[model samples]
Target: MTALTTREQIVTTADRLFYENGYEHTSFADIAAAVNISRGNFYYHFKAKDEILTAVIAARLAHTKTMIEGWEREAPNPEARIRRFMHMMIANRAAIKRYGCPVGTLVTEMAKLDHVAREDANKLFGLFRAWLGTQFRALGCGADADRLAMHLLARSQGVATLANAFGDDRFIRREVALMEEWLTAAVAHATPRPDNRRRQH
Candidate 1:
């Protein structure tokens, strides 16, 4: 595999540090040390911490978009695609247990800090919200798709938070199973509009 460029290395290190340590807590010195680069070199890549944050958020957004598209290609249908999302809690249980959801934790930290990049950070959640909404719309939720998406997102975030707090893998498993069941019921009971039905058929 190709090596990451110095700029990429800096952003990548910052992303992990910000997720593992709160954004306000991670310093340029910390990221520089993690990347094994001099602080002067770090300044060349990122003049300020906020700049690094913007790059990190952008990287996350791009990675998330790619992941969602991969899920669409891999899953057979909307229900299955949505299930893959719900199953992410189980898939990343170790990380969630260690640090909570990356997006959730970052947003919470930014909000508390009253940081300028709060909106940019929140776009991470918006990406999931929009993708989940698309999946629900395909499953015939109509105008309720975004609401359903938010509900599922909220549930996942809550589970991640509690799982991190308690370090409980069993809780993660149970929650993931419950989400799958919820998705199945939602898909079964949904009544698509006539136009939506025609489109599906």
Candidate 2:
């Protein structure tokens, strides 16, 4: 693979730092030190910390979109796709235990700081909400799709918060299994829309 440019490296490092250290707490100097670059070179790439934050948010948005798209392509059906989303907790259990969900913590910190990029950071959650809603709709949830989407998001957020507090991998595993079981029951109860039923017939 090709190497990331200096600007890309700055944004990536900033993203990790922002997640590990709150946006309000992390300074440009911190990033520069982590990247082992001079202030002059850092300013050449990002004139201010806000610019770095904007770049980080944009990069995260693009990465999240790509991930959801990949799930859509690889999963055989909507239920499987949703399962993949739920399984993310188990997949990133270590990180969740240490730092909490990256998106959740970032958004929470941004909100607390009253940061300018709070809305921009929140778009990450919006992307997942929309994608999950689509999967629920496909499963014949119809008007309830958005509600179910939010419910799943809230559940995951709660699990991440508790997991981080407790640092329990077993908790993550149990929650993931519970979520999978919930999805299976939800799918069984979801009546196919008229058009979908006709198509199957």
In model 2, state the lDDT of residue 47: 88
My TM-score estimates for the predictions, one after another, are 0.92, 0.93
- Candidate 2 lDDT score at position 124: 95
- lDDT value, residue 21 of candidate 2: 80
Kindly state the number of residue pairs that clash in model 2: 0
Q: Which candidate is the best by TM-score?
A: 2
lDDT tens string, model 1, 176-195?
99998888899888974332
Off by over 4 Å in 1: 1-4, 192-201
Question: What is the clash count of model 1?
Answer: 0
1-201: candidate 2 lDDT, tens digit per residue: 122588899999999998888788899999999988889988888889999999999999999898887887778678888999998898889999999999999999889989889999999999999989988988899899999999999999999999999999999999989999999999998975432322121
